[model samples]
Target chain A: MPPKMNIEPEPGDQTPEVGAATDVAPLGRDHGKPAHELTAEEDADGTDWGRVAGESEFKGLLASKRRFIVPATIFFVAYYFALPVLVGYAPGLMDTRVLGVNLAYLFALSQFFMAWAVAALYVRAAGGWDETARRIIERLHSSRKEK
Target chain B: MSTPLLMFLIFVGITLVITYWAARRSTGSSAYFAAGRSIKGWQNGVAVAGDYMSAASFLGIAGIIAFQGYDGFMYSVGWLVAYLTVLLVVAEPLRNAGKYTMADVLAYRLSPRPVRAMASLSTLTVSTFYMIAQMVGAGALVSLLLKDSGVTYQAAVVGVGILMIVYVVFGGMLATTWVQIVKAILLMAGTILLSVLVLAHFGFSFGNFFDAIKHVTYHAAAGKVVTQDFLQPGLRYKPPYGALDLISLGMALLFGTAGLPHILVRFYTVPDAKTARTSVVWAMAIIGVFYILTTFLGFGAATIVGRDVISKNGGTNMSAPLLAQAMGGDIFFGFISAIAFATILAVVAGLTISASTSFAHDFWTNVIHRGTERAPGEEVKVARVTAFVVGGVAILIAIVLGPTANVAFLVALAFAVAASANLPVIVLSLFWRRFNTRGAVAGLGTGLLASIVLILLSPSIMTVDPPTVTGAARHLIQSPPLFPLENPGLLSIPLGFLGAFLGTLTGREPSAEARYTELVVRANTGLGAEKATTH
Candidate 1:
């Protein structure tokens, strides 16, 4: 048999009616007991006291996500804005050669590689912040059980 | 029968067989519409590549390179890079949020009615433009290949339309995916093989190839470049923009790939978010290899066959076919031609399916079935019917417009429409939490209207005459003509962004920040699976 579920339904919970009674009976038997036992013991010992600290820090991490967005927007705008003028008027300015390839071909190809690199960088940077927020949220949820 | 005709018959037979198989298995809407969400990651990944790379990549890029030289390769690079954006930001988020179409994601936070309605309109507009472009491309490909057979361009467009509609009406996504997979494989193999043969003929020396090109002095006035006379050249040919046009073309290539709708819909087929991410990586690899091979083919066409001989008839669309005939005999030429035809078919089918899904699922089923508790199977049936209707409409348009307009030009216009309308709404909805439903609707409407209005009033659309050497076409409408720009991406993309931002400021702010936060958390992490039973 599966473990019992201990999570109580909130007021006016809108769980689907189709398979509700039968499904909840198995879930209660499978998951309810261990979860309730764990919360009760933790509550007695005040084990999850750091939730307040975690919530404040999670808020700080969310603020940093805003910082990366501005620089990214600036880079994209400046890069794209120069395109039409360069294509229309400054073909001669790009006559210099890089390796066997001309500056024109080199710059064009590099833009693709650059876009990918920037996206990877954003993922790496933002991913760190997102992870921190997730951890903080997890910590708060556990602490709320103790309270 | 000629080699191209023989090969075309063979591929058409294979496509028909696959369609029959798909139709037999497609009992209900789920199987026909979303393939019952049972498609594996890698399979969907290849299908995505097939869907994304249309006649634009297979035929248009090579044609552009044959005419314009090194600048054309910039488009290939730009298109490949756009996938990175799709992989990182769009693929997983889209798959996680919506069960089927783009409307699900757009309206997830808002009321189903408004969200579905606006999303459907955006989808229809984007899809129609895209489908018209594909139809135009198909017509051009048929005309180019069958010009010697004494077939009119109108007949060719009608022929392709009939074939595509037959494919869609029978098989749906299953048929489309299989056709795309087969076509993509054939196209990659054909290009790769031709590139090898071209390089081998030139003694496999890159330095020698470049040296050979230096001797070729292209004559613009006579419409032929003199290749043999290096010591004493007859005429000097100079392209208008030396380098800057490279950057403009490159920017258009890069962002335009990300803005495509048929490509975006492929992400929804995967089973989970992680699968979507991995699928993107696979697509990038396949695309990178294919593009590198195209460079070899482009340079080979320039050096070996000589542009003068190829452009004897008209334009660069025939350059690759001519080069194939030169390097390899009639057999290889026929194979390449057949693959090109398949490329057109696969791309058109993908576009038709995406458009149909948007109409049936997003517009009718979601909007019309707003309060109803219809089964998922019923929705799929509606989508399949919508696909057939859309295909019929496209065929009619292609037949009607076959005489005067160039299909390639129409394809470019579609890209411009996609970039102007869809890109803004997608980007804002993901990043900007303040963007309300009213704001999204307004931005989409404005962006689409501006692009359409600009395209209609532009010199290219008005003159309808082929652009001449001296650029001597008079504008039909005299009033309110601001810039001579052909592409509306320069103006309309920003207009879309501004409209959305301004519209958001005027509307009431959504009170579902906490709900959005919870949804976002579920989407980003894999925790939603655990909570499925709770709902």
Candidate 2:
């Protein structure tokens, strides 16, 4: 058999400490603590995995994100499909005038307004979601430190 | 007395004022590169719109529509829809992850050195291709407007280059943003005015307008329908695409927007990932409307203006200018021309700034200056110099290439490069945890090399016969049977993914999952801000 190989850990690796810790030891002590006590300590230590995992605020924010995605996708895809059809099949439809512009021109221009409206809607809806998400993250972070 | 010149002067004056103000405000690197990250959400949204819309949108698409009929609209649709991909995949992640360039985001999880170097190289490549296209377009616009003024295309290019260099060197993002904002508004207004006039010509009757276009048809020439072919009494309307060209064009637009570096950097100007997403939604809305107007302008040019005029001087490319000349006269023509010039300047300025920032912040400061906390003032100085260097290089390339190359072809090459070099790395870095530094380097290198090689061998480059490569030899080697299709997206994008995957498998796994996870969380949730309060 060939000589045994040696593999060294990278300097950037801080994973050994975080990953290898099987039991929560008390602050300033070497003794292992109970799991429930560890949980409270984890929160107090401001690295609370439980709070981060259980945060409902993030769920709410994600829900809003999903809502925005669904509608925006519909509008954008519809517009994309509309292009070839309007040009190839409904040539006459585009030529019809609206506000001194043809239907095609009007629709193209309207797409911008629709985009702005969508943005405005996003801002109004997402503004709250972003703030709430920030709050939950902060709260969890603070909780982790206290333990 | 000419409205065009007056409008042009007015815009120049406004831009100058903004530049001076920006110069005063920009004290260090952060201010020059990213507006000190204090720019409001909505303002950045408008600036994003300004940066994203280029001469291609203002002139190329409209001109294409006027010349090629529906095919032009296909380009417009492709351009706009690609933004959705940007919104979904790139914007928020990009904004949240890194401080400056797209490379910053890609290299965040890895060692800074190699990642920054590679990312800068990609930025330079993409920026150079994109800048050349913009310059070429600018030259064309100048030539069209000043054909009778004794101004050469070279002079036009140089003049625009000077304007762009000055804008970025002195004013930074402030100058870039203000010019873009003003230009965006003017472009929209000009198109809106032209649409109104076109409608008025038809007595505001949409039915009559459609009837006019329905009767219009062009004879097929060289397998491509020449719009002028239809002007005569007997010609028939030949559609621009049969099937193949449509797919080729659609794929180009779809992947192209996702890859553009200048546009991607705009997301960083916003406050957070959420704002970046919102800004994209705004950019999409603005861009969507602009494209729709272009379609009308194109059809109006085709129907109202005689094809004989447009075809005589450069065919479809001159359709919009000719239409402007017809409807608005010398003054109106000058006004539109000036706006077009401003459009080029604004875009080139933004591109130069983004490219330079990638070099300075991502490469020089982050990668090269690793282990050193970059002085605030020094970072800005490096970026400014990089801007000058990038701008100078672009000018040299533009001069070498001259004004003979097609603007659309250059733009397509830019798209191809962006898709190949940047997109694969960006996508993998976000989704694949297995993607390591080696994987990123390989993917970037492979994608870039493959795309460049494909483009060189493709019809565009091969068709240009040189003494070194005889016509017969060129033809023999011109079409590679392996990748019969010229577009690299269908080939290179996959290669990028494959290269990245292989690199990951061969490389060592990242040893710092906890820290990496923490960084990702910090990037995603702005968790680092809490640390700031504690400190």
Candidate 3:
């Protein structure tokens, strides 16, 4: 074995989703080789991926992502920026007393919480998204191998 | 000379050692551009944070708050929220799709030549403007720190220019990444120390700190007395267009960060999409802590250092260092000043490599060589020459423009170009299959032109304050601005998106549309993405 940098994840574990493409591992690893040495087999058998793009699962991935992202972006942009907009237009409401600090400071502090929550939520949701991408790649590889 | 200059030499020495170490690893184009995609997630996370926080964020935001009060905190809130856009949308897709430059993604489904040419133009323009701002800011800062120590501003400008160029020429991306990592560590430590000192001064009570911020008073430009109630807004925003100006500036920062060519290219340094995702989280966490502490630093300057002295010594940019001097005398001041100097140097080096890489990889080889990259090691040679030229021009411009040039406007312009020009194409080409070569060209051209023209006509350029007007502002029409708003993001971003949609409807490139399926699968799954080359 080459004394690889420990920066890499455990060899096959990183590719567990594409586990079906194990037969094509040698061809894919040829990316480190010179450009001309990259044979057509890298695109022929388990490597050709055009069929995977057209699958319904792929379209569903896009749709589901849009479903999460569209609302999240709208909510965060509106909620976070509302502090500045309201503080500009309606100063009295923001200046209303709470603790030693004013209402404006409280609202500003909440934005940090909202950002952390949203980022954590997305990372959690993306696990499922990654699984779907793996299944699509695996299915394409298995079909190509049978051929 | 003094402790600050001595400290600066030590900083240069450390980076030189790192550059010598990196020079061997950076022989091939892949290593030079993407560090062979070998950087670990956490180290890259620190480097990315370093790239994002300029001296402007560290010194500039605190100074703005010290002078302007609660309205200055708005920048912190807006800047932090902006990262969500990067994390939620841009990070993973960009890492998987791009190899060296953002042009890789933009030209993936388009005609490589014209698409790359336009992408390269936008990249050079944004990075050049940003580099000049950093150079000029360094000159201004050096003059303030070395008042009677006999170092001229021109010498300061040349020294910074030479140091940054040497790092790129000798070290390339690997050296740049490590410099950024070290700088980030130093900045975070300095900020934490300053915050702790400020809290101690207030009896370690949060209430006392807040009370002091509410009570500090400053002399307004018009000779009126302004008491800073640090929690209430509008010390800077005074009615009418104040709300509009706030929104426009907010929109630019929120969208601009994701589109920055330097920032976007950093994603390619890591090995996989998962690493890219984690990097964003780590960067935001560190960046958020720094921004939040600005409130303490700014308030400490206002109440402790006194507004009159800060403004008299070096304007708003000197508040943080002045606060350090007030807190711990001259030694702390020297340490803080050296970090400020290193901050500017690291950021400019990052900008230089990104701009040079786009020129060679995107335009010179892809456009001129017809994507062959024909001769071995040719791209690396072209990139080195371009880095030297870019650094030289920035030095000449900084020298001629002098120390006090009003170049802060250039930072806003750089952000505007990134958000308006570069961002629209990256988004559309990745998600919208019908987006064609014509649409990519149209989006880029419209965004670039719209941002430039609007900024020229806007209040920031037109309505310059009489006391500080110099260079082009002295000869320009000085009155009510043709465009009422200061930032043009609200108008230009929509125009970019509209141009893309209209161009796709008008121009038909069937081959470009046909390649969209492959681009989509490759970006989503990393099926045949470029792998890290062997050592």
* lDDT agreement of model 3 with the native: 0.85
lDDT of 1 by residue, B1-535 (tens): 7778788889999999999998887765556666555566777777787776777787667766665665566567667766655765566667766656766666766566776776677667777877787776677667777666766777777778778887787887778878988888888789889988987886987667656644554565566645542211111113442233344344444455565768777766555566676677667767767776666676677667666777785457667777788899888878888888898888888888887887777777778877453774676667667776887788788776653344454555666666666667777766676777777777777777777776776544555333452221234444543434455666666787787778777866555342455445444542331111000
Q: Model 1, clash count?
A: 16
**lDDT-sorted candidate list, best first:** 3, 2, 1
Candidate 3 clashing pairs, residues 3+ apart or interchain: none
TM-score of chain B, candidates 1 onward in order: 0.88, 0.89, 0.97
The recovered share of true contacts, given per candidate in order, is 0.13, 0.15, 0.64
Off by over 4 Å in 1: A1-89, A111-147, B147-155, B222-253, B371-376, B464-482, B512-514, B526-535
In angstroms, how far off is B225's CA in candidate 3? 4.4
Question: Cα RMSD for candidate 3?
Answer: 6.2
Error of 3 at B31 (Å): 0.3
Q: B33-74 in candidate 2: lDDT tens per residue?
A: 776665666677677778777877777766766665655666
Clashes of each: 16, 18, 0
Q: Write down the C-alpha DockQ for each prediction.
A: 0.12, 0.10, 0.38
RMSD of each predicted structure: 7.8, 10.9, 6.2
Question: In candidate 2, how many Å is residue B157 off?
Answer: 1.6
What 10-residue stretch in candidate 3 chain B is worst by lDDT?
B468-477
Kindly give the stretch of ten consecutive residues in candidate 1 chain B with the minimal lDDT sum.
Answer: B526-535
| Model 3 misplaced regions, further than 4 Å | A1-48, A142-147, B222-225, B464-476
DockQ value of candidate 3: 0.38
